[model samples]
Target: MVTKSDTNSVQVEIVPSRFLMPETAQRLLCEIYKNGGIRRIMIHGPNMPREVPYGPGKGIPIEANRNLLVEIGDQAIELRVKVGRIRLEMESEDYLGGLKAACERALPFSFQFRQGKFFHDRMTTSDYAKYGKVEDERILGLIDPKAKKDKLAILSEDMVTFKEDEER
Candidate 1:
């Protein structure tokens, strides 16, 4: 179980000047994942609907053909949003410099990086009603309670990709 002390982890947010495409988002995410101190990550942006939501064309499939999959250390993450901003918690402030560098390498345009309390430190009523006293605090606000599909994906630093890179 996560305690109050553990919830005090350093939180950082990265907001790009514009909404990122899947390819750019994928590159940025892979770099962030490579740096390896991310305890939790949340991406925010406008949702891309799979079908028309209103009008006579409602319920019909949209013609938008976009690759929503991004590979990070052998893990393929599905992109549900346009990736305008990214909020994450780190183990410590020591990793901030490397994170900034990673963002610079991936993002060609300007971006903003700030530090503050962005995530919930404690569980909410909805969370309790849905998950019933979750033991893992890292994912407290990572997903929606009503959503049927689980959006949370866990990636380890000890994955084969990382191990292979270390051997070189």
Candidate 2:
């Protein structure tokens, strides 16, 4: 439910030829965020569960191989997807060229970038129920803007560690 500060944002959709590995996605995210002008980034992909859902291994806690620790500027973000499609909300169309170049540099495989609105810009029913009808559109579509804590982890640079024994 991430939104941009500016209403005139263009969504830069980057779809890879194949599902990206965690390392590749991490590298690409770091590169994109470092360039700035990117207001929000939404990654879309198949869900990866933290535990085995069925069979002999049902209910067993397991490491999701696709989960990655990506360093974006000073922020250490945990990517929860295998990274099928990345939708970036940019402040202006002026950053398109630089964004393209950055993507090209980070992604070795084939990918595509397009400019369009990929998400709902207005408030939804669930949003209203969760946070009420707030005047700020930035917090409109979000679930809980006033919450003291966020569900996502914001790790420090030194905490960018991964379990090597985890199955891939």
Q: Which one wins on lDDT?
A: 1
* Candidate 2 deviant stretches above 4 angstroms: 1-7, 64-67, 134-136, 139-168
lDDT of 2 by residue, 1-168 (tens): 975554566777889888987778877877787666866556667757677879998988766543467655665556555679887767788888988888898899889888876656677776666656666454332233333223322212233222232211
Whole-model Cα lDDT of every candidate shown, in order: 0.74, 0.64
Q: TM-scores across all candidates?
A: 0.81, 0.72
Give per-residue CA lDDT, model 1, range 1-168, as digits (tens).
844564446889999998998889989999998898877777788877768889999988754624567787776655666789999888788889999999999999999999987877689898787778766565566655555434454323344222111100
| Backbone collision tally, model 1 | 0
Which candidate gets the maximum TM-score versus the true structure? 1
Error of 1 at 124 (Å): 0.9
